[model samples]
Target: MRPDYPLKTDRLVLRPFEEHDLDDLHAYRSDPEVCRYLYTHCATLEDSADRLTKTLTMSELTEEGQWLVLAAYLPEAGRVIGDVVLKWISEKHRQGEIGYVFNPEFQGRGLAREAAEEMLRIGFEDMKLHRIEAQCDPRNEPSWGLMERLGMRREAHFRQNEVFKGEWGDLYIYAMLDEEYARAS
Candidate 1:
């Protein structure tokens, strides 16, 4: 089994989801700007709490397909400004998917990328994963750009992967192998 792990970057700490992060979860998940790309649409405080509880429950039990979500806290501001995750783990492939969300208020600060880089390190080096992939709606340019900036290549474009808000949406898949990450770093 792949073990849960924590990673740290210069200005961010990538760690498991905590019960105390309810406020941060509510703030961003509820924002339309933030949830535009998320599978589940914008959530309310109650909804975020319900989802957080479910995630925490699965994490506590070490469920195989569950994600380990990390809150991006800015110490100087004394707030959680964003989150990153390593999810959809497959033991057979030794691989997983990575995703992140930043508070609209924190969008320009570079905190999300800082947090994601640390999670990528854990997924590649500590977990010994063969591949890490990220999928985003093609129209979400910011997220797609982030995948490229993180050294992952755009590997596939699945046309009309799903219908989002009544419109057909295409998904762009970006991926990196452990060897590729090591070479680029």
Candidate 2:
């Protein structure tokens, strides 16, 4: 069952992952800087390959809180620089959660935001989601800042919420409701 994908933006195409993305995926996924906030650490080549293969099967959300992962493709550069994950947390609640990762080289280019904005559109306008939220390590200024810049309000700052990479890490939750999205537009 292929998930409908290839969502596009001005500078990106959010499509399904592919075997060809192995090198690029490993390049970033294996970087400590990139995996700092993620649950897992730097991945080996086999790990990256396995991860990519798993992503290829998850192109759409499921009823049981599964993620619909999309590859962030830069057509001009002709490469996969990152990926986006939109998890369907609750169909009854119409709630969703989003996450993203991009190559460090593309950090300041606003590509993630652009791609994320499109995902927001997909959640709100297409999927009929009532709420969309994002959570990140409070130390990850870039991630939380990007969420705020996307018009999501800071809902909570949980202190020492989880033991991440050994030590407890604080978390920040950002969200935008459907009505809020409507008001923003």
Against the true structure, what is each candidate's TM-score?
0.89, 0.95
Q: Where does model 1 exceed 4 Å of error?
A: 1-6, 57-63
lDDT of 1: 0.79
Worst 10 residues of 2 by lDDT: 1-10
Query: Model 1: how far is 147 from its true place, Å?
Result: 0.5
lDDT of 2 by residue, 1-185 (tens): 23456677899988888889999889889999999998988999999999999998888665648888888999988888998888888889999998999999888999999988887888888788999999999999999989989999999999997889999899999999999999887
Best by lDDT: 2
Model 1 has a clash total of 0
- List the global CA lDDT of all models: 0.79, 0.88
Off by over 4 Å in 2: 1-4
* Per-residue lDDT of candidate 1, residues 107-159 (tens digit): 76677778888778768877778999999998899898889989999999999
Error of 1 at 39 (Å): 1.4
